[model samples]
Target: MNVPGDGGKYAWRTEIRTRRLAVPREEREREAEALAEGVAALNAHKWVCAYMPVGAEPGSIAMLDALRAVGARVLLPITAAAGPLLWAEYTDRDSLQRARFGLLEPTGATLPAAAIGWAELVLVPAMAVDRRGVRLGRGAGYYDRTLTAAREDARLVAVVRDEELVERLPEEPHDQRMGWAMTPFGGLRRLGGTEAEESSSAG
Candidate 1:
């Protein structure tokens, strides 16, 4: 489908990437620690799909461990050739090995894309996300393709830095909207979307 404002999306990506790279190492580590604390405070889900933060990403392996400490079984994504993401259970830091696109994935049996059905919470990586839940990804379309397999009741949360959560973003029909934005200092902020209403009523 035709996604309006392609130029705007690209511009946003460039700006965000530049900003992320400029973050000082000390601040990045501090933010990572805060993210772990935020996740630890949440009511643990039985199954949580999360990613290992690499480079300038705002989280650390501690976030995954926090989820585990809260009695959740965590699943990490395994990237493949241009389709929905495969999955594998996250055991410990020892289970992670470097994979394509500079990502760290679990060294275990690969689960099919449909395994997303097992998760109640999916922590997505994003360049930025808006209050309306429009997530600006890296333009690879991995999450756009994979999140379709998530359970209807699943929470799609974008993991970002505090500054990456904005008031607006360019969105397209094919883009999957996040229900929540998890930030280092901000914690979890509910976004405006169908999932938000459902989540609020459920609570």
Candidate 2:
């Protein structure tokens, strides 16, 4: 499967990464805090699948803690052998340990890839996402591969900064589309895909 790593996609990634690196430490922390509060307000979900932001990623550890405080049992992804991602329960900040691919994962029981099906919401990290729900990942295709097992009703939300949410993005058929976008400022914006269509046509 072709990941977004060449040509237009590669250029798009470079631009987003550059912008992300330019974010000051103070602003990042502030946005992260706001993200925590925003994510916590998503109380409809009890079991959530989320990722820990590393390096210049917009979110901080507080995001996961906020999810936990909302009585949601959060499941963090663990990088496994070259394939779909594995899963582990996020008990707390201390339970996370540095792991392969520069990721911090839970040092607890590893669950099967299908464990993601148990989640009502799946929060995925992205460089950028468009209004149409197209997400630009880190050229790994990890989420694309793992999301195949996500329950049909599960809300796939792309976690990105407010500015990172744009008008359009390059999308492939194999790429998993997001139903919502979670940003520090916007909190959660419904994307312009089937979800939006359904919602609009309903009322």
Candidate 3:
């Protein structure tokens, strides 16, 4: 079932996954704390769609709490079959349960994919993201499908470590571009698009 253009993506995923696994646990914890702080500083949003990081992913559960503290009613992805993701409200760490793909998901009532329309901001998980807004995910295509339901004005932001923010990455037609990247130390950076242009001029 391999697609013609997927070989390059496969290689990138392997390399990134290996690199993530090499990061020390202590460093990961520190990055998680910094990420939470970064998310906390963003302008408050009424609704946000975010994910719970697992394994060597660049964030922690605290990021959810930070979003909540910033006045967002946070929604976390709940994996279904092979289409767009379902969502559920994130109440607390205690509400999370083990799910498919080794992900942690909230136990609240599941909402349909269209629930993404409620979010004013969508925080996506990426193995890497380029300045061009090309996000390299784990190749699941889940976010790709899910984000199609996001509100037109919703800000799509990728959460990654500083090193994972690069200048370029392979892109596919079906891949959705992120408008911003949130790094642990670097905070929020505008990616390719109108926002990037505005940020450049303001600087």
Candidate 4:
């Protein structure tokens, strides 16, 4: 559902990015740990497509480990030219190396973009996600293009901080809505009114 006039995409991006940057280092770490625990609690999925959160992003190395602890095959994204994102298997923390945009990618074999369809769960990076499931990325269309290949039954989850989940955001025709969101305080929230409970749980 598109909500008119929630601010332009760029402006909303700037505002949310500023808030994320303002988070203290210690707070971020604590939140990352909480997020890891939350993800670990959901052990149903076998293959999960996720990202290595960099800089002030909401996750940590521990989050990936938590997913792996559940015996899931984790797939990380490998940045490519202006097109759909490539994929690589994440063996461990040691397999990661710095890539473009200061992102960390796996050193394993790079898979084609269509490989995303193999995932049962996809944890997407976002600056913020609204109650209606609109995700605000870093103004890049990587996920927007890459997510098209995800299996229709695959759970599309946006990972964001507790406060970053808001009421609404600017949306575009190409912007995909996430089915769920993982947060520090809220474990797994079904967005777009699938579950209307107030996300006030503790982290």
User: Whose TM-score is greatest here?
Assistant: 4
Model 3 per-residue lDDT at 142: 94
Give a tens-digit lDDT track for model 1, residues 1-203.
12245549987877787888998999999999998988887777999999988678789999999999999999999999989999999989999999998999999999999999999989998989888999998888998999999999998889999889887888899999998888988788888854444232213
User: lDDT tens digits, residues 26-106, model 3?
Assistant: 999999999888888888899999999978999999999999987889999999978999999999999999999898999
* TM-score of candidate 3 against the unseen true structure: 0.91
TM-score of each: 0.91, 0.91, 0.91, 0.92
lDDT of each: 0.87, 0.87, 0.87, 0.86
Candidate 4 ranges with C-alpha deviation above 4 Å: 1-6, 194-203
Clashing pairs in 4: none
Clashing pairs in 1: none
The deviation in Å at residue 153 for candidate 4 is 0.4
- Residue ranges of candidate 1 with Cα displaced over 4 Å: 1-7, 193-203
